[model samples]
Target: MADPLPTSLPQDTAPPPPGIGQLFLGFLSVAVVAFGGVLPIARRALVERHRWLTPDEFTELVGLAQFLPGPNIVNLSVIVGARFRGIPGALAAFLGLTAVPAVGVVLAGMVFSRYGDVTAVADMLAGLAAAAAGLVLAMAARMAEPLWRRPQAHAILIALLAFVGIVATPVSLPVLMLTLGPVSILLAWWAQRGRP
Candidate 1:
């Protein structure tokens, strides 16, 4: 297993409030630090370093995000942004997180066809491929750990089923939500009613 994370996150850090600058910088920092794996750092920066949300609250938001249809990062940006500022906050976060990376990728892709065949470039990319795999695994575990504890069995089950359903066909995102969201909500309601 990987070594334990830092015992105490840096003490000098400060909480973030609603400001376009802080919101933008917070996500930009996460995006930059997120090289091999961004989710872990992103979570720490937003929930821990910034103390924008309690760890549990962050986990709940992240959980809702994963089941949503877009890229996980975009989903996260929406939730975190909305929490901190509002819909505009969400947009700022999304732009901050996505814009630079998108442009960088476009530039890289443009160059890749020309440079891709070079042995050194190919070797570098090969390593990145492996690292990217690891990053995704880390992201999966980060997402899964919380749900296991809270034991949202039905949501988990529905997510699993929705995953399978998506895999089984080429359904669009809206349709997939149409298929899964209500069912999950109904199940959640039933589960809540059964409790207490």
Candidate 2:
């Protein structure tokens, strides 16, 4: 019998790409909802709600974003926008993603500077930090879900090695990437080479 899993990540038939307005609003909504971290919310918005990208696509874009300079989410926003609607779309998504958050940060900074010494204010900030940590953990699990579903064991093995290398061993990120990154690309290419 043929292998059940596709040689590459499965691509669903996606809806037409979003217009500039939609891109703006989609990212705006993500910005408004996700306070400290946006990955979980962005994933939900793009994959689950909008169906703009499949889970695997989201993971791929995020991985690329991580390798680029600047904030991962910022890079993701720009990449998605550019992929869909070119330069204008990139501007729209970038503006939508940052505008409100930038204003909020400035206002928050001012407020915190004033009330930072208060016990209640400090406690609230502490609570937000804890919540952010939880969100990060949740997002990490969601990101790994695609890898778990893929049939090829090599993907999982590579992910495990990278995790162990980073967390348990003393290998630096650049060193680890230099070692495993090429292997990953080659494996992915080889896996799909038979596809028409």
Candidate 3:
């Protein structure tokens, strides 16, 4: 007999979401092409190429990293690493993603600092900033698609609350996770607990 509910099992798990090699290679590729726009590409690479993190997992990782110290990319690598292979994976991702980029930045900053005040550099920075903003907007739309489809009012309300909470103050994401995330889940759990 066929299972009543359909499930989407992952296709590959041999090397894990991010294999050891992908740790370096994936970040390196994103870094080179990312330029002023990386969020979408990074999402695709992780969710599609390496399968390091699912779309939902990727968003949580991005949000978690945004609140932590260091660069967003560095934080992202750590989260991806942790998810992919536990502590060792996190370590591998951190070293792989940040090492080369850090070295390159040091070298480039040395050269670029001398010409940092150049008009060309300013224009490039401006362009890149615009690109980053667009990338972020796209990510928002992509993330909200499924949420809009879900037929749960409480879930939607929780999301709206999260959105408002995030914008209303300098609230730490950890706090929001602690307060709202679980409460929302618990509310649903409680609501259904008495259902036959």
lDDT tens digits, residues 1-196, model 3? Answer: 9768747555754344557666767877776666556677788788777666767777667766766766777889877777767888788777876666678789889977898799998898789799889998897787666567655667678778888888997888679767886778787797688579
lDDT of each: 0.79, 0.90, 0.74
TM-score of each: 0.74, 0.85, 0.70
Alpha-carbon shift of residue 136 in model 1 (angstroms): 1.6
Q: Which stretches of candidate 1 lie over 4 Å from their true place?
A: 1-16, 66-69, 159-177
Q: Pairing residues by index, what is the TM-score of model 2? A: 0.85
Mind giving the per-residue lDDT tens digits that candidate 1 earns over 1-196?
9998888757656454758767888888888767666678788887767787766777677767866878777898888888778988998888888877888789899899788889999999889889988977776677566667778789689868877877787887678877687888899899999999
Worst ten in a row by lDDT for model 1: 9-18
What is the full ranking by TM-score, best candidate first?
Answer: 2, 1, 3
Top candidate by TM-score: 2
Instruction: Name the regions of candidate 2 deviating beyond 4 angstroms.
Output: 1-13, 193-196
Find the 10 residues in a row with the least total lDDT in model 2.
5-14
Q: Which residue pairs in model 2 clash with each other?
A: none
RMSD of each: 7.3, 7.6, 6.0
